[model samples]
Target: MPSPADKLRALLAQDKLHVMPCCFDALSARLIEQAGFGLTFMSGFAASASRIGQPDLGLMSYGEVLDQTRNIADAVRIPLLADGDTGYGNAMNVRRTVAGFAKAGAAAVMIEDQVAPKRCGHTPGKAVVAREEAFDRIRAANDAKAAGADILILARTDARHEHGLGEAIGRAAKFSELGADILFVEAPRTVQEMETICRELPGPKMANIVEGGETPDLPHKELEDLGFAIAAYPLTLMASAMKAMVHTLERLKSGQDRTADLMDFGELRERIGFNDYYEVSSRYETSRRD
Candidate 1:
């Protein structure tokens, strides 16, 4: 299998921006792959919200995230890049971060330059570690992979808000020097800042396209032109799903969540691979003699 990093790097070297929707599980990954996208991302925001019912605070551990990444990777055939928030603490922690995710079948792992108990990049009032500290973290991740060539090390900086965009770009440049394959400068609030970053950063770059947040929607083509090789639309599917779930629950509480308001069971089944469900159930339903 081509590593997600390899695929991403190859795509970056090409003519346009690649759209990678964020996927948190096997089902979503399979759906994205079936939809014919070449890239998929595992977002910390979605992971925490879906699995743990919590914020993207550093509260989630490496082991917890590892389990989720494993399930998602096993569920799909495509390369997946995962969020390793703050490397779970320091450079040493990053060694295990790479090893764990690689074992779980992640094609790439993204570690951010944030303090412990990391918050989502889009969330307000974020801070970052020193430049040298982030550099060491990347070095440790790279070294730990140990010619695990298929696995990629992505360096992300939340420094855009804390230290300014220029410093973030400078950090990205240094991260590239430290052997990071991809750079994620989290949350540029303006198109101009984004364009400046695109022009300034010397290595491969990834963009976070979060609707209704610090990032406004830009046509994928425009971002590609600006030099973002990959754009991760984090939280689209999960956010939409959550909205639907809330609406459905509200309808039910109001005695309106009926078949008329919902898709037929057959449709629901089809969407979740219910036909496959029947085939498996049928085989097991019959006795050995039958």
Candidate 2:
């Protein structure tokens, strides 16, 4: 069977856009795979929100995200594209970050151009590092991947807000030149801007569809027509899960039974491989007894 990285590369070679849904945990990764998605994305925003109960303001450490990546990768057969915000530090740190994620089994690792302790792309007052620093970060990531990491490098630029579209495009182009497997120009506000980004960017482009974000929420077909190789809905599952949990909790507090609204216990157990664990246990028990 092809490795997850190979699968992602194959998907990129196709004409259609590959839609990657974001997953914050192992369970969500499994759900994404069961729903027939070819690939899944690990959003820093979602991970921070779920794991630390905080915003994606760079509170989570490299080790924290790496641990989550290992769990998610273990739960699904599909390729996982993880967010490696600012490569967790400088050029040397970027090298270590790439190696860590690769060792943790990420198919691709996305490193953005924002400075350390970066905020979400949609958040106000965001800033990017100098061009030289950004280039060094991507170069470090590319170098690490080239040195047998076996993971694709996704180079993202948050310069559209602070540096204008031209600079953002230039940075993406440079990142591609430096051997990034994918290019992402974050938070393009309009369809025209998205078109320009897709048209001008050199290689496989990624479209980040954040719910209620600065970018326009164009359909997959439109994104495909605009030359995007991948379209990532980074916040859909997280937002839905949050709302559903809140509603269920409120219902329970109001003396209502919301169990009917959830998956039955048996089905939930099956989905989580309880029967498989029991089968393994039975085999071990018989062997040990003999």
Minimum summed lDDT over a 10-residue window in model 1 is located at: 281-290
Local accuracy of candidate 1 as per-residue lDDT tens digits, 174-264: 8888888888888898999989888888777888988887975899889888988888999898998888888888888898745565778
State in Å the error of residue 66, model 2: 0.7
Q: Which candidate wins on lDDT?
A: 2
Cα error, candidate 1, residue 247 (Å): 1.0
Scored against the true structure, residue 8 in model 2 reaches a CA lDDT of 83
Runs in model 1 deviating more than 4 A are 1-10, 147-149, 260-264, 274-290
Model 2 Cα lDDT, one tens digit per residue, 1-290: 88778888898889889998999999999999988999999999999999999999989988899999999999998999999999988899999999888888899999999977899999997899999999999999989988888889999999999889999999999999999999999999999999999888888999999888889999889999999999999899999999999999999899998977798899889888887778777768675564
TM-score of each: 0.90, 0.96
Model 1 lDDT at residue 265: 84
Q: Residue 231 error for model 2, in Å?
A: 0.8
Which residue pairs collide in model 1, if any? 58-117
